[model samples]
Target: MSRALFRSSLPELGSFSAARLRPTAAVLPFSWTTTTTRSFNSTAPIVEPVSSNNAPNPTASQVRPLALKKSHPAAPPSPIADSVKNLLPFLAAQPGHYITVHIHGFPYLVQEGDQIRLPFRMPGVLPGDVLRLNRASVIGSRDYTMKGSPHIDERVFECRATVLGVESEPLRIKIKKKRRQRRKRQAKSKHRYTILRVSELNIKNLEEAAAE
Candidate 1:
């Protein structure tokens, strides 16, 4: 193709100075949104938050011992009733008497010279020590029986026992083991008993009981 023919065939553009550019409608600058905050006064006081876990706790060793409770005092003695005073001589006249004595709230139907093995060992007593029994519920002979309301008076009868010694049971060993375990636990237990023998048991006459 010729240069004149190519120039005549091409599209024409106007001068560059008269070109329409969007200069008045400019793009706004990018910005983040602002939030309003309240300001506090400088003279106001600040409160600290309290937590329960931050408080100090007391240990077991620093704890104080508890006070022991006071025991109830014993009751005062009373005189014998008139009905018992009248019939007491008849019960005391009989021979071969048997008494149901109580020691530590336990009943023992015993006669003179009978031996007793207490289930638990008695404390504060050694062999050959004598103990006077003052509590009894029933006292009877072969022909007559005398029953008391809860307990007979100590002035009515005299019973004594001599501590023999302490007897111990054989040691018992128990083995405990778990299945497929190499370690085993062994527990051993042995118990002791106190021996006592009744030495004297006598009933008081009417004059003797009244004088006491």
Candidate 2:
């Protein structure tokens, strides 16, 4: 009886599997077929024609005139005074001279071979570098002196300084504290300065300055 029931179920299962394996045709709407055919047949993109009335005109832009600038004449250069030209030669002939040279607006009275410690460190200078001192207030020897109104012309005198090395100050410690706080802090600072020596100083002759 169990074998007869199993044989009857096998025929129903075979019929269901044959129905699933058979292919079925799918039907689509007329509008869907038309849209797909149009997309495949189109080879170029569609562009609408632009009307000439809405286009910008090249001649419609107005040309503006440039403004005229005013012209001015330059003032004449001032010539050196006759008295200074006459006195320069007498001052240059004397020996054993001292110059009041100005560096960074501060005046330093220095002679040849005098070592100077500048207040600030000089940049781009190394040991044995020679620097020319141009600004001077007074240039004098044992007999004659040539003093400028404010500052003597740098071309009249020549002064050169050699860089020796940099000198640094000792480290300073300052104690900082609050009124009610137990914690205290110490601030330390050290400053470095450049050292220079006046190597050569001379007053240029009138003929020499004119030739240069």
Candidate 3:
């Protein structure tokens, strides 16, 4: 049927679009209530992982190669000089010998029964502990002298020292102040030294050295 005939059949549907359906911009009569909640203090509890030396590799392509350690090559041994071999026996027979013994790269000319004060304190050593000095640059007597370019063979001469009590210097205090200020800064320092006495020094004979 036509639209006019259908509208006349029902009077209740007359002018429904103009009365029931409101316009888009028009305000509603009853209150359409709606409850909405918002949260502002919420946070994600998941933590991001940090990269470090102990972290595991994710794939074979990401794996790093192991580092190789570098090592020093060994130096060849040097032969003993001809002059030292011939004169060692003559020097051993002489009496009253003195040797320049080296300890920690510092040389000290000491003989048997000579007391020496080391410039610094030697750690882990107590009184009466014996120390065998192996490095030397010179060994001599009244007339003859034997000198090594850097260090002599340890078998040529034996030198020993005994540790004595430590020696401490007197306490020293220095006061520093400004030209016009009463405030002063005091600097204090105290140093300790190790005392050692050469106990034995012997020049080995050719026969005795050969047997060893």
Candidate 4:
């Protein structure tokens, strides 16, 4: 009876051994080997993709400086052309002596050391006022100082005069009357004129002015 029980246990043990062998056969060495290779390839550095053909590098000379490529413009003439241009030629020729300077639209002419009694009083000036005479139509010399054709280049002359004092004219009366009423009013008015003495009317030579 003991021998029969031993035989039965031996068969059961063989069946368990076959089941273990089946599980061991399912685990393959190739699977672990392929997984390790895939991981290594993923971690490896990738080379930049290149074209089939190669090209040469560019140089610095081909690019231009922005400053060199930029541009500019021009300018205009001065308005004092009439006063200075004609006076310059005359001044250049003359060595000494006074000149009669005539302002544009004014009938009177003025010379150095001469006094000018204007028709109307000049405003905003006291005695001994130095005025820069900028607007002039004619500038004359003693013997052969150059005269302006009509207008002179304003750049030429450096003529300046000084104000002396104010002079008043005699009183002139104007009588005013109403058409309907028998009433009359007499208005008396006196005008004061500005007196100016020509101080300096100098013309600097081109060479002298430019050199200085």
- Which of the numbered candidates is closest to the native, going by highest TM-score? 2
List ranges where model 3 is wrong by over 4 Å.
1-81, 178-182
* Candidate 1: tens digits of C-alpha lDDT, residues 55-166: 2443334432233222433556675577577767777888888999988888999999999888888999999999998999999998767788999889999999999999
RMSD of each: 19.6, 19.3, 19.1, 23.8
Task: Please list the C-alpha lDDT of all candidates, in the order they appear.
Answer: 0.80, 0.84, 0.80, 0.67
Q: Candidate 4, after superposition: displacement of residue 119 in Å?
A: 0.6
lDDT of 4: 0.67
Poorest 10 consecutive residues by lDDT, candidate 1: 30-39
Model 3 TM-score (2 dp): 0.58
lDDT (0-100) at residue 97 of candidate 2?
82
The list of candidate 4 runs beyond 4 A from truth reads 1-104, 178-181, 208-212
Q: What is the Cα root-mean-square deviation between model 3 and the actual structure?
A: 19.1
Query: Predictions ranked by lDDT, top down?
Result: 2, 3, 1, 4
Tens-digit lDDT track of model 2 for 1-110: 99999999998999999987876544437678889899988868689765554424322353222232224224576755885688778878877889999888879998
User: How would you encode candidate 4's per-residue C-alpha lDDT over 45-155 as one tens digit per residue?
Assistant: 879765433333323434333334323232455545554445556656776644445543564566667777878878888998898876555555665454455654445
Task: Identify the candidate with maximal lDDT.
Answer: 2
What number of clashing residue pairs does each candidate have, in the order they appear?
A: 0, 0, 0, 8
What is the alpha-carbon lDDT for the whole of candidate 3? 0.80
Quote each prediction's TM-score. 0.57, 0.59, 0.58, 0.48
